[model samples]
Target: MHATTGVGGGLSDEQRIESAAHGLLRDLGRLTRALLRAGEFGLTRSEVSVLDALAAAPLRVTELAAHAGMVQPRVTALLQKLEDRELVTRRRCTTDRRAVETSLTPAGRLLLDQGRQRMATALLSALHTTPIDDCERVVCAAQKSVATLAEAMEPEAT
Candidate 1:
């Protein structure tokens, strides 16, 4: 098997860091999709995201769209599918009669729980087979990197 490396043999610190970040992002996307499929929930990634957001609290379609990073029309369509499956319900917003609020049903909550358990089992199984020291190092690095990025991304105080 050929090893994948940065464009050039020698790289600066910034280049190496960028390369590693790209590879990590690619692997994370692949692994997340695999884990989602392993759950066998028959839900698309977008659908799962919608469910996850609703698990927090009921929201209007526009709010759900923002939470899911999707457009309102797309959220409405997904909600239709979820409603057909009896996983979610839409009702007129109590505070705003003009707006509709969507919430997860008991079935949706149960499905989400099962999916989470499956994902946890898969992650635990993978972690069990890996070296503990390496896992700890990587986890620590990831945490630090995420925290740094988040801090950098925060808006400046006026």
Candidate 2:
């Protein structure tokens, strides 16, 4: 089993930590699902995932495919679709003769902006209407968890 997975029977400290991590992941999943269900924008999950990833930095098709956990051909097809929609643009990579880097267009950025705002407004209103603690704990814990995960996944120094 994976290290994070719990074994059968009684729980160990590792198992408890794993359980908590799983619960946090589930909560995040629920949050994503609810936001998607709100229907503020009609973007597909894959498109949204691509746009969001590109918002961080420009990436070549192969790099983007790796980042999106998809193969090059699939990502290439999606990039072509996004290109046709004017949601993204591709340019020849300056450093490579045979590679292209994909970046978001003004329209794509605007869509992401509006979609983010709509989701934020809906979530803020919902959370405020409830007696929750403003989601600070969840945000902080998730940030810390992601940082630790990044660190753990990094290659060891030679």
Candidate 3:
């Protein structure tokens, strides 16, 4: 009757934690690959990321780069492509003519709306493969774990 033994009688706490983490990563990787292949909005991974970021608010090019964790030049290139597709628009910064801010166009919002539905459908289908109670429990625990990790990583109060 070891503390680590489960109903199956052979797993340690360390082993269970490791197994859960590995499974989560594998599931997420598979989910991401499927989403990319579905081409819900005809956007590349980088483009989807940029759009998602901009959905939060309009941002200058530099701010976008920071939020996207990309170099400014790469972000600029992505923005150019998004603009070409009419999914995003850039305007001269009122206070700084040398800089520009970018935001989603109406068309972009439409695209995001459709893309989100497709994504939700795919995610729901995947989750439905698991038991309902298990799915809810796992998702809740994962969200809490993520929040805890974020808090732990934040700079400590002075």
Candidate 4:
């Protein structure tokens, strides 16, 4: 916890930062919902989840199922649909011929990238009312935010 300001103030430093972060999350949730509404992406949220998982690296059906919180049978069915659409490909793993690895195809990557661009546009539009006033600061902040999030996503060293 941070101490209150020496002068009379409404919120302490910690409280101010916490509130700002919370507001950012809320706005992001709203932005995501707006982008996802009416199925504009032409992909179900579950299908998108699988693609997102594969964007990191090729994974077997079981690994994808675990990452996406779905059962192996369900993931297999979903993978079949994605593969049929040419959004993903499942091929024999190089290290283990018996195992199949699933990866995002070019089409799948394009869809995800477009969605990200749209979301970024929407988020920047929302920030217009804020005091940012310049694109450079916004870009810097966005980069820092992404770097921080990527760091958080990594496994902690033992």
Candidate 5:
């Protein structure tokens, strides 16, 4: 019996890992979309990304655009929508009067909290449904994998 031969036929370790990674990514995407659809205060993926970035701190339009990986004009349009909802506010940068800075309002923070809570609830439900031992092992392995990737990807210190 070759290492790659099984009921499903030959699959190298790399092939198995790649298949698992793709499945995980697809499931995550599905979960996110489902959660957004089920939630009362729904937000588009781009909106959520922008809000997550702004959660760190207020930033100028250019900085926010970079953080959200969006073009300035698109970000500006999104900001306008957020402003209309009173979820964010924009003001002239004191130090750089020519630049406009945007920040999450209390409402925005509340929405972010709600979104996080929904994610936590979904994750907890999954954990509860799975066997405890299996969950623990999988989670531990995932954490180690993430850490390994982060370390490998980290830039060299000056």
Candidate 6:
């Protein structure tokens, strides 16, 4: 039986890699949407993206926009909404008075944690039919893949 994936059907290495990448992106979008279905965590995808971006460290509005792949104005609006809910806090930067730094509040962190747990539980239950060894491999590969993408996006330190 022929496998549906293009990663190893006697194609060129580059072609195989590209096909796998396309598949990964397509499935990733579906998975992301599934995780946030109907605002499962009382947070919009954009809002969650912003929160996740801030998880690493506080960021200026421009930095946040870059991280979220959004325009500054839209990100500013989201920040305003988050601030109103006390899920995020923005303050003038100590090093640069003109810049505003945004950080997640404890509430925001807790919400994120809860959302992660929910998704984990849901995926675990849904994967009951899959073999345990396959699940373990997928989980490990996903973590490494995510880290690889994160590193690719980072700029070189000065």
- Best-performing candidate as measured by TM-score: 6
TM-score of each: 0.74, 0.76, 0.69, 0.63, 0.68, 0.80
Per-residue lDDT of model 4, residues 44-123, tens digit only = 87888898898888999989987887999999999999999999999999999999999999998898888777766765
Q: Kindly report which residue stretches of model 3 are placed more than 4 angstroms away from their true locations once superposed.
A: 1-27, 129-144, 147-158
Give candidate 3's whole-model lDDT. 0.80
Clashes of each: 0, 0, 0, 0, 0, 0
lDDT of 3 by residue, 10-70 (tens): 7877777667677776776676778766547787888988998889788898888876778
Q: Model 6 off-target regions past 4 Å?
A: 1-10, 130-134, 149-158
Clashing pairs in 5: none
What does candidate 2's lDDT look like per residue over 25-138, in tens digits? 678778887776563657777888788889877889988886777889989988998999999999999999699999999998898888888876676677675545656565
lDDT agreement with native, every candidate: 0.83, 0.78, 0.80, 0.79, 0.78, 0.84
Model 2 off-target regions past 4 Å? Answer: 1-11, 23-25, 130-143, 146-158
Question: Over the stretch 35-126, how does candidate 6's per-residue lDDT look in tens digits?
Answer: 77623679889999999888888999999888788999999999999999999999999999999999999998888878888887777677
lDDT (Cα, tens digit) per residue for candidate 1, span 50-148? 998999889899888877779999999999999999999999998989999999999999999999889766765778877777767765786688667
Clash pairs, candidate 3, are: none
Taking all chains together, the TM-score of candidate 3 against the true structure is 0.69
Per-residue C-alpha lDDT of model 5 across residues 15-65, encoded as one tens digit per residue: 766776777667767866876654435777888778888898898989888
Candidate 1 positional error at 37, Å: 1.4
- The 10 consecutive residues of candidate 5 with the worst lDDT sum are 149-158
Which run of 10 residues does model 3 get worst, by summed lDDT?
149-158
